[model samples]
Target: MTNQGTRQRFSPYITFSREEWRHLRDSTPLPLTEAELEQLRGINERVSMDEVADIYLPLSRLLNLYVAATQNLYQATNTFLGHLEAKVPYIIGIAGSVAVGKSTTARIIQALLARWPNHPKVDLVTTDGFLYPNRVLEERGLMKRKGFPESYDVRRLIQFVADVKSGKPEVLAPVYSHLTYDIVPGEFIRIRQPDIMILEGLNVLQTNPDGGRKRAPQVFVSDFFDFSIYVDAKEEHIKRWYVERFQTLRETAFRDEKSYFRRYADLTAEEAERTALSIWEEINAVNLRENIAPTRNRAHLILEKAEDHTVRQVLLRKL
Candidate 1:
């Protein structure tokens, strides 16, 4: 083959099937029990012990190694400068479409990585907290675009990530409530200096050259991340998951009087499914295609999921 033709077909990622990736688990042990995992998994996600052992265990071992190496480099830099520098937390960004289980992945990875002796403290912050309040979104006529990049208080979100990455002693992230579907008034999640931080959201890996505000920095959130992961699956599967989760929530959170989706609580099974599918097609799917999926290749690693919510392939970007 001609050199030019050969180069055209080159793939930058090393793809591994479930079994191939499972073997990479090596001596890593599963630290969480069945009960603990029950708490970690999402409403519609099918995360099991086998999934953890085959997928996350190996991934966590890899992340542990990355964190350790990064720490060593930080120390090395300080040594060369002949001065002590504050240890910065290793930030990990997990991005994917809504209802694609990125949140669950982030939690799993956080739980796994925290058990490692070297990096015992792991913090998780989701971008939902950075989304504009309902009133603000309404003012901007962006209620339908809640998960879109433009619906975020981008400046504040960037500042939060910057502050955390700068080793700030205390940082407060606004709390977002699923039931209320808004940023909780005056509520916040306090984050101390952690060994590692996992920031999960749809747009963590996305970059906007001109942000919504005049003073917003052009810096991407992934810029501060030492590593990034994109949880991926076929759109059809994700749509099904979304519809299923919405139906489940109707029986649970939507029944709460305070829920933003309380009106949906009375929907029939068919009506609920139709509504959820409509939402997927209108808002979430559009966001995924335009802003989120485009950034998948930006991730250092991508976890491709099967229809049953199992991770079928792990694609690690070649160095």
Candidate 2:
């Protein structure tokens, strides 16, 4: 815990309570209806309309201003260069532990930012697509370590982000499937030029990921980000949410024929719960403590969540 003492510094972050942060919304209207929000919520993640109006609306408004300012800086640089060039998209990176509702956060932020008139085309991309396929992981004996830093194709992920940030007219990213638990071969998500791009993943802020067969890349993913957010919650809260989600998936996705976890479909309530806890304790919790949680302060902003999954405090890095 001494490292945590070293890592947790008060000087960089200006902390705001939920009430104080929500007031910063400054009349920004809630963008999504109840149905849309419900659709966006992750398994076992409770996000209400009030969460949006209070937490996300203010966050979206801040992002809009940042994007506009970035766009202006781009124009100014172009003017100084004496030639007009295509402007690149503003990249926002979201990092968090598993079952902390990162995908929901990314989707909600994408929807809200796209609704802003200035930036109508906002794209959301996850680093899941950059993960190595099950075949490769099996070859490397990494099936149990899937979410760890070494399990990713870090070089390819870096190249993809570099291309996007460089304003490549069209870029392709590999597709990943949660149900099958593998990269979908020959399937890709094509990203056209967008006003903003949100990149969400567990380890986006990782500066140096080691212990793989391949050497670590020289570049960090956060280097290309205009701004970044880390979704923070207690480890116990995340583990509980993960187990609950696993149980929910046991009843739903696991029942599908194509699910990688189809064997779990017939598990009794006790068996399912026990299995979920074992996986979390053995795998996810280790990764969170060793790889993910340490990168929290690297974010431009940190959303500290309560046990109930509500934003209790917002920590914006001091400029």
Q: What does candidate 1's lDDT look like per residue over 19-88, in tens digits? A: 9999999999899999999999999788999999999999999999999999999989999999987669
How many clashes (backbone atoms < 3 Å, residues ≥3 apart in a chain or on different chains) does model 2 have? 0
TM-score of each: 0.95, 0.95
For each candidate, the alpha-carbon lDDT, in order, equals 0.91, 0.92
Per residue, candidate 2 scores C-alpha lDDT tens digits across 1-319 of 5864555454588878999999999999887999998888888889999999999999999999999999889889998999978769999999999999888999999989999998999989999998889999999899999989999888899999999999999999999999999999999999898999999999999976664446667788899999999999999998889888989999999999999999999999899999999999999999999999999989999999999999999999988
Candidate 2: deviation at residue 76, Å? 0.9
Off by over 4 Å in 1: 1-9, 209-217
